[model samples]
Target: MVRRLPFLLGGIALFLVNALTLSIGFGFGLSGVPAALLIAAPVVLCWYRPMAAWWLALAGLLLLTLLGPVLSDDEALQYRPWLLNAIPAHLAVVYVLALSVRLRIAIPAFVIYLAAGALTPIHLLDDLPNAIAGAIVWAMAVLVAMVLGHNKRVRLTSTLRIAEERGRRLVLEERNRIARELHDMVAHHMSVIAVQTATARYRLPGGVSEEASREFQAINATARESLREMRHLLGVLRDPADPAETEPPPQGLADLPRLMESARRAGTPVRLAVVDTPDPLSPAAALTAYRIVQEALSNVVRHATGAATRVEVAPDETCSALIVEVHNAPPDAPPPAVERPHPGHGLVGMRERVAVHGGDMTAAPTPEGGFIVRATLPLASSTGAGEPSPDVMDGGDGRDTSDDQRIDRR
Candidate 1:
């Protein structure tokens, strides 16, 4: 109420003054038509629209001009040619000011209205000064309307952008919270299950059935492996700048042979071959390549029991790309399909890894009863020839002398 006190008092004051002026029937201090429009235009624009306010202005003009003489019983002013001319002219100016709010009016329209209104008193009442005063009043109205319209548009746009940014930040925070919960649950439960299974197996004596022993041993082994994979997934989500972290293993073309050997131990025969691997890939490129193979082989172990797998890692000189392809073919009799489904996270993560360095990947099943996963990682210079030449990955040569398993956590 305090903020609006000044406006409320000013409006009541203006109404009293306008009424007194009309009642006295003295010559209008500035022309009665323009004075009323100047006071009412903004209030109407705020509460209503350009067209409705324009109609109101028109009706008001008619009442003020036509009824003034009737109320005052003054024939001298009512039929006066100058008063008649000025009345409609002022109404036309009000209509233009209202229309300007709804459209982008050209400068010519305002100029023409001012030019014609400037001659009203001169032609009708032989008074040039009054005509000039009326022209000045109309010009100021157009200026105020343009400023309000521009300010309103800018304020609305800024408010919308701020709201959109706040919404995006909320969504990102929620997703991070959910991911943390998933990691903690998987790690704790799988670790506990593996430990209990191993304890149960050791307590059993030779008198126990062979089937029971085998079942306990397999369960223990599988659960332990699952726990390791879960830990790796959690580590990937860690912020890189933390001081307590250790570097993860270096995974690139050279690791393919060892990965295949690990699969062979699990009773899945794997053939590994490497070509054009004399030069090591960049760290990002290497990690993406490793994940592609890891996800594919992990799928094979879970879904294609007793399957034969082969991995091919080759470099295409023409394209400057490291091509990795992993294929798996199960026995003639299809292995019982385990309902284990890929969560799409592993595949989506692989693609995100490749996309960071602008590479491509594809995953699909072959018609020959096998699944295939392939990726082509580009190994261009990290700096793209735009910076000072960088030192090679290991000294000046392509060979990386650092321990292959050592990861640079810092």
Candidate 2:
């Protein structure tokens, strides 16, 4: 409705002005008022009822052409040619029809207008050149209106296509993320069960009874069955159309040491610390914590090369949640600002991960010219089990003891 406002206002103004001009020129008598109303009807009706407007315009043109001599004195008739008087209403009807109806309907109306002009008696058959010129000009105005309507339809179709493509892309990305989360949650528990069962079987004393050994074997079998069911469930959640694409399982806190080692090798000096004894984390919370640190380190590597970073993980005193923080100092010689990639998608991905687990995360610049990312993931009662599993680390302290490289910067 709002889109039609400009056309409505412009049409009313044009019709009123034309009607007043013609009435004043003809001395405002009974004949002049009726003729002026005939001229103005098409433009006014074009706004609400365009098809009716076209019919009214044709009737007005035919009336003026046939009775023009009787309605006006010779002086008034000589002042304006019949063709000139008909042009405004004729053009207004054609323009509105072209925009409001299909080409099949609008073209026939134009043909009817031409037939009416041919039947009129005012034009002398001997004046062939003038009649031909007038017909050509009227046809050209109708053609212009058709071209304008065609361009508008083309632009609207293109806009709708672009919007549809964007919506599909967003839905595909979200499905992929959900698949990743499911794989991470199920795979982590299965891995822990497998590793723990194998370790217990190997560490058993030589004098162990046959009954205890069979029980160990039974536990291992149960864990393997659970893992097989998990794989089938994950397959159902994945996109069936793209069977060739497979997503790897997501990493957790256990993978942090390897991630830090990779960053160190990439030339960023990193320090790791765990202030309190680490507790076993649920798969969702662990994945969220890992992703936050991963994205933060990735940003530092991409934007703040030659900088030093620190990663800290500690359990809350109440054992209700785990706090994780990744901090990176500004590079000794900062890179150009334009060299940094736009941070839109990466930050959005991090926020989505945190929101899924109902965690709070913040990334901000520090007072001493550095960047820090802090996250707190709420812990569930089922997450508190034994100590950190051996599959993630081999030592009691949650620190990587691999080769460390020290670099000195001025």
Best candidate, TM-score: 2
Q: What is the C-alpha lDDT profile of model 1 across 164-212, one tens digit per residue?
A: 8855654443344335444555666777888877787566564456787
Top lDDT model: 2
Q: Tens digit of lDDT per residue, candidate 2, span 1-410?
A: 11556555655555566455555654444566567667767777887888999888788777765665455554333212235554666666677777677778877887887677654434434555665666677667656765675456556667889868865664455446656576756777777887677567567666446787677667878888888887887777666764453545446776778777767766678777654434456667776777667677766666676678888876666667788888889888875453323122445456566777777888888999888888777776534433532222221112221111111110
Residue 97 of candidate 2: its Cα lDDT? 74
Return the TM-score for each candidate structure.
0.36, 0.45
Off by over 4 Å in 2: 1-6, 26-70, 74-93, 116-129, 189-410
Error of 1 at 145 (Å): 3.8
